[model samples]
Target chain A: MVEQALENAIPGDWRVNERLKEAAIYSLAAGGKRLRPIFVLAAAEAVHGDEKAASLAMPFAVAVEMVHTYSLIHDDLPAMDNDDYRRGIPTNHKVFGEATAILAGDGLLTHAFYVASEAAAIGVPAERTLAVVRDLARLAGFPGMVGGQADDMEGAQGITSIDQLEHIHLHKTSDLIAFSLRAGGHAAGATDRQLEALARFGTNVGLAFQIQDDILDITGDQDKLGKPVGSDERQGKVTYPYLIGLEQSRRRVEELTEQAISAVRSAELADSGRLEQIAMRLISRDN
Target chain B: MVEQALENAIPGDWRVNERLKEAAIYSLAAGGKRLRPIFVLAAAEAVHGDEKAASLAMPFAVAVEMVHTYSLIHDDLPAMDNDDYRRGIPTNHKVFGEATAILAGDGLLTHAFYVASEAAAIGVPAERTLAVVRDLARLAGFPGMVGGQADDMEGAQGITSIDQLEHIHLHKTSDLIAFSLRAGGHAAGATDRQLEALARFGTNVGLAFQIQDDILDITGDQDKLGKPVGSDERQGKVTYPYLIGLEQSRRRVEELTEQAISAVRSAELADSGRLEQIAMRLISRDN
Candidate 1:
């Protein structure tokens, strides 16, 4: 579904400036799970609104992904994580050179907002667009993802508690996901109560997703994951599985997954059944 | 004057969380010539608009300065430029350590747009607010400042031509100034022609400022400059002075200053006199 949405969102006029056009396509085409946009689309659909409202969410969805990608690129720099592989391919700095990769990441992240603002101006109502912009700014700003990153950088040097770990994951991962859900709901003119429920749902799912990732990093097959296993351990970084035993972490994932479903179900959204199904599928996925 | 503007712009009710407030104040209250905001105010005044109209431009002006400061912080990182001083004091990383400095830079940059958007929402019409957002987006994006940084990074490893040097300076320095001027005019509801003239004036001055900087780096007193002399040469970086010699660079500055003055004069604005005077003063500045 996201693949289709991305294809539709990217125009087919290929005769423009080749450099920019190619860069945009190359970055977008280097695919990830499209988790952010899917959450957006699902949340909008859960409110019994036109799927077309998802169109309003695309630029932000793309922007969030770009920011995420840029962070990964920088993290892989020699000054940071220094990883050589990502998604089974040479990291951006490896393929494009450190300078180009850095600029490419910067370009993508900056352009993301531009793209989002253009969409907001044309498609969403003024007030709603303003709200979307606010939500995104908060999600990407000091108290959200960047703050989380700062904490991660600092925390990596010392021991940390489960609560602190949760704080980091909430900001680093869940904030953007929550924005995705809220933005979709806003686009669909969802009620305040509905938006709150979507936020709750997104937070729970996001936590569950991170916990599952912890489990995978510790025990999952490297071949299946397409990245080194035990890297967190190697780096002395804390994770859910490390703080709470793996068994407990797995149990926590189940608990969070159930809470996520309960939040969505309790909302009594008329069209929420598919989203619930997807949430269940996500928590149970193997690879 | 800039201090008064900043004091007014920053929220006085510190009733919120103390730490976040402190962080904001500590960074913002650090001293520098608030050239960007001055440009904003001057441009609005040139259009016969009240300060209220340019309030939207304040956050943007602040954001530009934050970006400039953040760049200084990061560029001073050991892996980057490795400078020890900025604004006559130890750089952020020097005082705060590498990790905190990195986070501070990231925090400042991300928070900049948040502040700008909030200001836009409050003081400007929705359509005009969108324009401010767009102008900021373009100024900070790859084709503008970041692209210039990329060019600078690449050029550092090799020699560059006068044209390439101009392009770098245009993107690195001029774009934000141009945005400030244009955004101020935008807030004042300047006609398209007036806005164009302001942009032209800004572009010329922006380039002239770089030429002046190049000359100062070579010829200015180390005591007054507040840093080591010949730093750019030490870094093996290219500059206008490096390429054209001091005499030719001075001539270029004069030419660009003339062009800027002419652009402002050509506008024939009812309230353009102050702006013209400021431009002239900026070019003739000795420091």
Candidate 2:
């Protein structure tokens, strides 16, 4: 269902420039694991067991995926990470050129709010919908993801400890992941306590996820990872393994994943099974 | 008042990265006419005719200005227009590196919605606030400003007539201007008729504003216009004065300004004088 909504997020036909839509659709359609959107859905289902209630969270689900995709597109720009490949395909800028790619990223980021606002039309209360929009922006904007990116770029030159590296990982990865879970909870009318639990679960899982990514960049097969793996080392990017060594990074992922699972189980959710399953799955996944 | 709000829009002492904040503040403080924000305030005052109600629209006013600034910052990037100067100062990318400039623009764009959502706290209904979010995104995203930008870049090569040039101008400039007016009307709880009138007023004034900008690019003084003027011709951009003669373009600006003034008068606003006066002022302005 989330897949279909994403496929149709930007209409194929509109009065505006077709190329802009084409470029936006290009990156959004270049599939990731769709993990963020799945996190949104799982968090929603954890709060409200009924299928219809969980479905009410569809717009938020699609919205997060759009944000994630946009960040990747911009992150891969020639002026940023300068990656030519993402998700086993050419990056948006590689295909459409830098100017259109930048605008495509802008379009997707702006349109994500439009998609999130549709939650109101889908029977989600306006207050909750507004809060979700606030969460999305606050967690994804300057004080969160973008700030983390800036720090990652500048702080790489001055890094001396794991604590500072964790700071970057928390904002760059955990904040948006936490926001996804919180938005799902908001859509399902989850209590403040329940939302807090989901945030904890998301944060732990997100940190674990990033650690696993760093480990994979050092050890995984390039074909399975679907892109060049050792680029982190080439770019002098500080990662979990780079600071703490591979053994410690793997141990950290295990501890974080366990904490994430425990948070979901104690949340008093309608169905904590999916959240727990996803958490456990993250720790063992090869991709 | 709006100046104070824009100046303080991004907090100085945030826990996140400071460079991102500085780069965003650099372009924002360089200053334009603050026309979009004023349109928002004027529309709100026109509807409610009270200082308190107009103040409720302050967040939206700041939000539009932030969006405008972000667009300019991105537009000035090395991959985009590649300009080194804006408002007689170095562009964001020129001062900050390309990567930081891109993230700063991303940060501002995302934070604009955060600022707009503050309206709910200021007493605008949640439903109205949600509508404003939708309007802002739809107008500023692919269907509006971004799409127009993409079209402008690609269409410049194919533009052969005045109509095509106007199509680009209307979307690139007019849509956000229309959104600013509509958002203010929304803040004041204007009826559908009032909102429609504001839309018409914004659309006309926005088009007139673009035409005047094109004329100034050709005939205005270098110091007053800020940044170089003839770059439009150098870049082979299509303009109102290019396809239609300069005299015809001047006449078109007069016609649109008259239409905009008439829109405010017919709306039965409590104080149409300000809106009308601003529209009239556009025609004689040198800058």
On residues B130-185, what C-alpha lDDT tens digit does candidate 1 reach at each position? Answer: 66666776676667776677667667667558997898788878988888888777
Q: Candidate 2: deviation at residue A246, Å? A: 2.3
- Segments of candidate 1 deviating more than 4 angstroms: A1-29, A96-101, A157-160, A268-270, B1-29, B157-160, B233-236, B268-270
Q: After superposition, how far is residue A197 of candidate 1 from its true place, in Å?
A: 1.8
Q: How much is B270 displaced in model 2, in angstroms? A: 2.4
Using lDDT as the measure, the top candidate is: 2
Which pairs of residues have clashing backbones in candidate 2? Answer: none
Alpha-carbon deviation at B60 in model 1, angstroms = 2.0
lDDT of candidate 2 over B1-287, digit per residue (tens): 89999888875666768888889888889888999999999899889987677789999999999999999999999888898888888999989999999999999999999999999998999999999999999999988999899988898789999888888878899999999999999999998899999999999999999999999999998888875779789978778888897999999999999888888788888777878888889888999
**Tens digit of lDDT per residue, candidate 1, span A21-90?**
3444455567778888888877877786557766666666666676666667666766566777777777
Off by over 4 Å in 2: B227-229
Q: What is the interface RMSD of each candidate, in Å?
A: 4.6, 0.8
